[model samples]
Target: MHILILGAAGMVGRKLLARLAQDGQLGGTAVTRLTLHDVVAPEAPPVRVPVSLSASDFSAPGEAERLVAGRPDVIFHLAAIVSGEAEADFDKGYRINLDGTRQLFDAVRAIGEGYRPRLVFTSSIAVFGAPMPEPIGDEYLTAPLTSYGTQKAIGELLLSDYTRRGIFDGVGIRLPTICVRPGKPNKAASGFFSGIIREPLAGQEAVLPVSDSVRHWHASPRAAVGFLLHAATIDGARLGDRRNLTMPGVAVTVAEQIEALRRIAGDAVVARIRREPDPTIERIVAGWPRAFDARRATELGFTAEPDFETIIRAHIEDELGGRIAA
Candidate 1:
């Protein structure tokens, strides 16, 4: 099957690409072609599958059409401006996140002749703002607190509506904040969640921008790629009309994350974290969901790290080659 991955250059996108290449299949079907698109050119991985790389803003006119012209069996829409960056730049955020998504969905719809692809969209838990229960469930209303959340929420509605119209088989996964992200940080509001762990593990001092008491949802990059793959193959009829579902995640406080790091790495590594609270980050994080019930997704066979330590360990194993700074 031919597969298309939007935002193929991002960390999660690259991981998904690697997993697909290693498995050589999607839902047991052999992957014959890989069409990767990103704002910047994605480095071609040394894989046997025939690959096509394109660098351009998909939100631009006619670009989305060119992407779906191949009629890939599965399309993974992982591209977005992220939370902090979206909130920082309103026009660019809406242009890329909201407008680009609509354009792509429309492009698929325009391809009639019974052309339907499994469109897996990466959404976020931020869709359900603060003023929520401890473990938010699937039935909760989507009252987003940030511009990024608003964009994703709109995309979710569009995905469902388009699917109902027989445009495409869509599945929206509301992802948690992926922690211990490898490489340098992007402008995501939750980047600090990974920063405090990633930087210190490399023997570098890291800032704690929020209070230790701050709690939030988290998942590992490995688990996230799994979610994308599963969504691509899961039966659409089983999902019924609710095409979007929150994926399972480990919920923990900032203090708990630090404790987990200390337990695994030792006192010196944990000591590298310095607390210098930033009000901007604190205010933004305040309106985010802390935990989730995710019973629907759990019943549907999605899984994640049970605890923060396992997430840390996964990062260490996958990115750090099972080794960290002393």
Candidate 2:
């Protein structure tokens, strides 16, 4: 099998690459070649399979065409402008998220007869807006309150329509906020969810932008990669007309996250979290979905960390080599 990964330089993308390289196969078939693309070239991993790396803007004219020319057996679309950045820069968000997605889909369709590949798109729970049910169900209508969410919702629609028309076998997974993200904090509005735990465990202070009672869905970085892989390999026939799925995740509040940190890393680490409310972030997060039913995804064999405690331990083991600051 040949595999193509967009946004290959990002955090989840990098982890997905490591998993693929380590296993050297997908869906029980050997991956003979891998293509990695992003705005900036990705560092080539030490994989036995032949690998190709490209740095280009897919939204730009002619670029998307070039990307799909190879007709990879599987394509994982993980590229998008993050929430805070998307909200701040409207044009860049729509251009990269909406226009770019259309460009890629069109390119695949233009390939003509009998050329369908399995396409896995990374969507977000941000696709659902406020006035949400406590545990948003699989049947909930997407009413995005933010530009990032709007783009992802539209992308989900496109994926469904294209799949229905047999252009490709597509699956869109609405991922939850990934906690204990290993890296410097980026501009994503949900960064604080991971920051509060990650920074404190590393003996650094982190700011909590939202209140203790503010609850949200979360999954570890490892679980995010698992969702991507499952989407790539799952039997699409069972999915029927609904090509998009809300992935399974644990729902916890800021206080619960802190308690989990305290349980695993001691009170000293928990003390590193300082409350500094940012109203803008709070407003953005308020519009985001706090929890999900995700029964559909769970039934389809996609899984996540059961609770915040397991999430924190996964971070410590995976990113910190199971060691924490004393």
Tell me the lDDT of model 1 at 50.
89
Compute each candidate's TM-score over C-alphas. 0.99, 0.99
Residue 317 displacement in candidate 1 (angstroms): 0.8
Segments in model 2 whose C-alpha atoms lie over 4 Å from true places? none
- Which ranges in model 1 have alpha carbons more than 4 Å from their true place? none
Predictions in order: lDDT: 0.95, 0.94
Q: Which ten residues in a row have the lowest lDDT in candidate 2?
A: 43-52
lDDT by residue (tens digit), candidate 2, 1-326: 98999999999999999999999999999999999999999989898878999999889999888988999999999999999999999999999999999999999999988799999999999999999888899999999999999999999999999999999999999999998899999989999999999999999999998899999999999999999999999999899999999999999988999998888889998989999999999999989999899999999999999899999999999999999987
Candidate 2 clashing pairs, residues 3+ apart or interchain: none
